[model samples]
Target: MKDLLTTTSSIIVILFCCCVLFLGDDADQHLSEPDSEMITARNHKKFLKARHPLAKTTLFRRVQSVRLKDGVLMFVTADQNGLKEHFFIIRDKNVILVKKDAGDMPPDSIKFDADGHGGIQVTIPNTFELDPLQDLLSCRN
Candidate 1:
């Protein structure tokens, strides 16, 4: 009976030690991750401050173009003061608009037709000819 009791106590202690060791390792791994993330954020802030003094300055930047499939659906190269920098589209059926900070300054040869609401649409030839160089199928901007 004494031998049995000794064996049981040894097994219990072994299991308790294993659990403590594994839990300690997991805790250490998790503890290092947050510290690295905090260090990275701190370093990026220091780099930005040293490189660009006016990085935090605020300035007005207005939307000027809404394009769909290489087609200039809307064009506003320049906006007048007090005239809205952004216009809301009430309806854009079958249209995916892209916002461009550079505005609609396409080559002069690509003519635009009035689509109303300060927007222009690219006119395609009625013959249905495709430009071999132009591939506007991708959904990504």
Candidate 2:
């Protein structure tokens, strides 16, 4: 019985060592480098912190999408009651207040287009609001 127990313990130790050797490098790399999704989430959290320092009732409900063309970010905020939706655009690291839209209509999609003068236009569906792409970036969340 003693010999058998020793053999089993040695086998288990060998298996564990093998696993660690084979998986060690990949595990270290994964831990050291964060993926794009993690980076994006971190950036969004930072944006919220910087934009809405004193916000309690109003906070970001959804980050619709991030524009790939110009790396622009779109965020939607809702009041505590969720009765109003506030749209915001982040470009060049500046957060711009786009519009305060009604919450009755659900947002379908967002369209992005070039404005010919080195700017991009954003259009939210189900609304007739113009693209406030050039709006001031002075909103306090």
Candidate 3:
């Protein structure tokens, strides 16, 4: 009878240790950020800092062109303002939206044109507007 109790206690102790090790409370802290939010935040940061400051003036000139590749659907507008041009190349959807800043100029217009070869060109005017991309993304196929 003592042998049986000892064996049962050992098994219970082992099980408890396994559970504590494998299902520890520390697991939650290590989780990575969601993909969507990460993408949005990264893109937002790029817009504020202007990854290529010269590219803004040179690449965003009037009638300038911006191309987007597959899996890359969002972009900042050429305008110095904080507007972002989000595109859904899968469905040929495009929209203009503005980002917030303490001291930023407003953008005026956003234009979207598609190339026959799965490419898109976006143009932004001098003023900012609401996130038109949201409405475009919500539409059903």
In order, the Cα lDDT scores of the candidates are: 0.44, 0.47, 0.47
lDDT of 3 by residue, 1-141 (tens): 999999999999999999998877567555544433543664887656543423321133232323334433344555567455655454544423233441322232334444433344545443434343564455465
lDDT of 2: 0.47
What local lDDT does model 3 show for residue 5?
100
> Candidate 2 on 7-105: residue-level lDDT in tens?
999999999999999899889888877553453764977655553333222223333432222333444443455544333345464332334453633
lDDT of 1 at 139: 27
Best by TM-score: 1
Stretch of 10 with least lDDT, candidate 2? 51-60
Which stretches of model 1 miss by more than 4 angstroms? Answer: 38-43, 47-141
Instruction: Supply candidate 2's per-residue lDDT for 41.
Output: 60
lDDT of 1 by residue, 1-141 (tens): 999999999999999999999999999999998766643664887654453332232122333433333332332334465434323232433332322232334321223334333443343222223341343454234
Clashing pairs in 2: none
Number of clashing pairs per prediction, in order: 0, 0, 8
For model 1, what is the alpha-carbon lDDT of residue 71? 34
TM-score of each: 0.30, 0.22, 0.26
lDDT head-to-head 1 vs 2, winner: 2
